[model samples]
Target: MELRLTLSLTAALLLPGLAIAADAHADTAPAASRQAELPAWEQLSAEQRELLISPLRDRWNAQPQERARMLEHAKRWKALPPEARERARKGVHRFEQMDPEQRRIARAIFAATRDMSPEQREQFRKDWARMSPAQRQEWLRKHPAPEGGRGR
Candidate 1:
């Protein structure tokens, strides 16, 4: 709902006290400087460089604003404590392994709950916690992931 779909996972990596401060002006001088010092394609690790390759080899330019946000997010990720980093890595890995349909369902669920009031959210949590494992499984089976997968 807040349009943080791209970096929500990255933001979740932060502990409450250490969450990166939101910047109203993303094109600030420090961000510009960081972008200027971004590593060249050849300088990145194989996995990092691979992210730049388009499946169709389409020509594109990375927007400076987007690049700055990425670098900022990376800096925050690197600064996380080892335990936090490991937890974040496991979460990201799990998300990556989800099928398209599962991902679509997850996104929908996220959107649906994103703005819930604290009391409503707490009640939902309480209801979930009250469910038995078998009940949870049955509920999931009844509400399967979207069949059509993601939409354009």
Candidate 2:
């Protein structure tokens, strides 16, 4: 569930460049450059489109119970305003930039308080920031991270 929350948070900006980069024989450039220059959906071939959507498809198949929630998330993402979508894309990019440990803490915190109001989340973050390392660890221990939300 935690993993689902973290992933759903980014569904608005979930362009699978990996699908493009996976074309080993065709893409002559280095993998990094290929990923950097991902083609638009219409530009890609049928295979590329399949590869792009495969992860989401596989995840959907694997988690039957979460299908309704996941579908709702996609609908909500589509319903967001253009400016709001851009902000979400930027937020995902910022989240991607954090170090591994920071990412772990972020995912954990996000999973813990995703249902809170904005003001409440801000207050929670302030309280979290005030905790000592040991206290933070204790807090984490008490509210352990879910299996797949470990910043993998």
Candidate 3:
């Protein structure tokens, strides 16, 4: 009788742990299924293909380093959440719409602000918000594009 009671107690303790493990496993099932369903290269649409291989003809040979970098970027991009991916796509679209001069100015501003502390960045935002459009234009004029051009 004592042996049976001990066995019963052991079962009771293990049952909750088994249940918790099963719940954790169930939560990951959807992500596992998603990973399983990764599309083949041929299955991609033309637009998707263009996005994957834009501005690169003969990517296999002409720019091997760039192609490798792009491949790494693609892997990281695929790991992003849906909302983050959407926001990035929108940003790219907005950047594409800018003229060369505007692009240069925006890039310069972004580079200048990239490493700023949170407080410093907030102060900059406040100062920018206080600027008139003409003042903003003048600021861009003062900080012309870096010499020797920008790439990457």
Local distance difference test, each candidate: 0.49, 0.62, 0.52
Of 1 and 2, the candidate ahead on TM-score is 2
lDDT of 3 by residue, 44-94 (tens): 788656655543444546767666665665576678788766555555545
Worst 10 residues of 2 by lDDT: 11-20
Best by lDDT: 2
TM-scores across all candidates?
Answer: 0.38, 0.60, 0.49
User: Candidate 1, residues 1-152: lDDT per residue as tens digits?
Assistant: 21233124333422222222223223556867967866886787775445444411232244454455555656887887888777666545554666664465454444344466757755755665687878755755665543443211
Worst 10 residues of 1 by lDDT: 13-22
Model 2 has an lDDT value of: 0.62
At residue 48, give the lDDT of candidate 1. Answer: 48
Q: What ordering of candidates by TM-score runs from best to worst? A: 2, 3, 1
Candidate 1 RMSD to the real structure: 13.1
